[model samples]
Target: MKAKYRRRFGFKATKNGPALQSTIVKACASVVIPALNEAKRIQEVVAYALADPATDEVIVIDDSSIDNTAMLARQAGALVVTSSMLGKGTSMRDGAAAAIQDIVVYLDGDLANLRPGIITSLCLPLLNNEADFVKARFGRGGGRVTELTAKPMLKVFFPELAHLAQPLGGIIAARRSLLQALTFEDGYGVDVGLLVDAYLAGAQLAEVDIGSLEHDSQPLHDLTFMANEVSRVIFNRAKLAGRLHVEQVIAMYESQRQVTAGIDYVLSLRKGRRCLLLLDMDGTITPSRFALELARITGNEAALMQMLDTPHDDAITRSERIAGLFRFVHKQQFEQTARSLEIRPGVVELVNQARRAGFMVGVVSDSYFIAAEIIRRRIFADFALAHTLTFEGDVCNGQLQINSAFLPDDDDADAPICKSNVLRCVLADKTPPPVELIWAVGDNLNDLEMLRLADNAFVIDPKSPKLSEEPGIAVINAFTDLVKLLGHEANLVDQK
Candidate 1:
């Protein structure tokens, strides 16, 4: 990127030059990278961020990649967040929303070329308070869409931004506070949208030269789509600024919803494990639903059937209501029911095989941990995560306690402590799980979250048509499919 294109730049409310450098507290940046199937090089990108002294945290938002991206990034020492298949904009917003640092920098995951000081160069301006938003201008980058669509549209609609070297560049840094305040365009337009939004919001923006770099070129078809999206964003922002008002707007995207993941809680899980394998308890570990079985055993069958037949409530409320039916049910009775529930075939063999192969096998459930533990012992799983059933004396008090591990940062529905959130928070050992994989098995939608986090995910006897709606999740009738997903991890026992 040469200085020939309008050497020094300012947009909207940004001053001609930054006069307020070096007055704030020390800067600690969070590097947020939105990745899809870039499993080939995500580790190096994450490592670069972690190695930088300026980076306080490295977060890779895995966009439902079928590869080992999430597990690998975590093993490489980054806090990994498993996002839905929404797109880059959603990933960016989620990453920044979860950032602990004041400064947030986003880098592309597939970059094969990177200079050592890239992060420092991007953060220096913001660190010293020289600017509120910083965009990276790197040399030797070939951005076909930027040259054709992004720049031309910028020239027509946002001429002040037309001079930017790489308007579509994903490498950008901004004040996390301001980034949160702006609405993000949740598609390929996120980068440019942020640029315009910052300018419109009166941010002091700077374009720093990061020197030579290379990026993987997209296929022609993908490029065509990207160009259209980029053009649309520029046009949309222009209309929002009241530049173009021809009747109504076209292709207006809803503002992105920011999420606050329990990153600290995730980082606090059991460490020093290599691989993590989570099996859903109710249907996978035990053939029958524990609640239904308990209802039958305790003579609360009629009440339990009524509760199940009634319209379902929110998970929290439904859990409470169900526990109310079990009021005065003794712990021993709960354990006895769990113990009596028949185990799925090949269950014991699978756990032993995985554990011997250096994997951490655990039982995952939406039911109470007390019952989950009873199943865990039968299967010999290393751990379990489930809603806690509070007891008064020997009987359930009809109150449930969701562990801090399963608790959400807010009341947001998507933020619930699903299997995905728990996985995002665990298997964070810096060196990694013994195996480089994370395998999860569940019978229903409850395990859908882990499908986003695990390198390999399997659905056992899928209970809903909605489960089939999820792409890439292999549905299996038994542990046979799980072993196949395990894909030849040898069963090697640890020799002390």
Candidate 2:
């Protein structure tokens, strides 16, 4: 359950200090996990990525895995993509190409005991605009091949990079732009190749401490093959850099000859509607937050403000507390306010078109299901998922029932009532055909998880400008853009 590799790290950058912009502009990242047949460990690895606040997107690049690596990753809320070829380097390159964030991180699938802040630590330098590329230095010492082969070779050939603690470490983060401009080797040489390319690209690189990254070490034969491949690439790069002579090239080829066999490049969720589109009712479908509207109209705005000012006791407790504020509100007034809220333009058409395109369109809200259902029918969605409010004698009874769909599942039992959990409940149904694409739209912090879980996400006028830096999330000002996006995506679905 824990990684054995551990090592200390010291950052050399003197230019930028700690990330003060973290409060306003998050250190958003797109995590690219190059996995191959790593079924047992892939799900946990993806979960580590998903749990990070900085990780807006978790992309699992399946390099023709034989096991359920891809399926488990998808089930764990990662965006899975099949590699064009069966190589870690190809997966890395393709993952970078697919990433839409400013920072792209590559994580080996087999790594274990990954700290929750791993991505944030790897990305902080880049977020503060200090480093162009980052390599993770774990607590454990170097692997056999790293010590016997990579380090010695780097010392001889690329002396400038000889100081790197983990030249062969697979945990790396770099600006997407930098990754886009670089090339990825298609074998065991990929990690070293990236280091050399980044150095050659004149990227300001930094290494940070990611404590206790442990994994099963490669066997002697596998280590031999890895050392051969790694040395081969380093020599090739040295030759390209004109740092090697005829004798060194001959020595490299000699080593290749010494190694008789080549290495195989390796390393390496859900049922429901064939496709699902979840729209957040408050700001997503109604263009305005229903809670704020209700508070203002009922003259209980201060009570609602108090709700925000108070620390949440627990999700259920918070829901009950907020529902208590509506005790003075009558059912008729609630219905009137829910019905009076204007639906955003193009929602009906988007929902309808999405359904026709094989998507089960629904509205998932943190607010009451009654209001959500009202909005859902207004847009003609298939269903609505939200908390339920009780009534007694035509007035709210100050008791709230959380939607089962919003409650935690077996994976995260103690977490808050998140829309993403509702999505999981829907996708977990075995009755529906396999889901093709999950499209989601939302507007605020509450909706962040839902958007992240969705394959295609649209954030309506995001409050935090940082959302724009996240991958697989689009910030839209108007509703018409969503209509167009759905139509285009629908065409792709139809073509498929």
Point to the candidate with the largest lDDT: 2
Q: Summarize candidate 2's per-residue lDDT along 389-463 as a digit string, tens digits.
A: 755555677777766666677677778777788667555543324456788888877888888888898888676
Candidate 1, 1-496: lDDT as tens digits = 1111112221112222221221221337899999998889988788766655466778899999999988888887889998755789989999989999889999999986565556767888887789999999875332556654665566656668767887888999999999999877877888999999999999998999877666676877997888788777888889889877442222111000000111222232334456778888888788899999999988988987777666656777777788888889888999899989999888898888777666777787888878887788889887777777655455677887665556554646567666676675564333223335678888777778777678777787788987777877777777854565443643322331
Judging by TM-score against the true structure, name the best candidate: 2
What's the residue-level lDDT of 88 in candidate 2? 91
> How displaced is residue 135 in candidate 2, in Å?
0.6
Residue 296 error, candidate 2, Å: 99
**Local distance difference test values of all predictions, in order:** 0.72, 0.75
How well does candidate 2 score on lDDT at residue 467? 70
lDDT (C-alpha) at residue 494 in model 1: 30
Q: Count the backbone clashes (under 3 Å) in each candidate.
A: 8, 12
TM-score of each: 0.45, 0.46
Q: Count clashing residue pairs in model 1.
A: 8
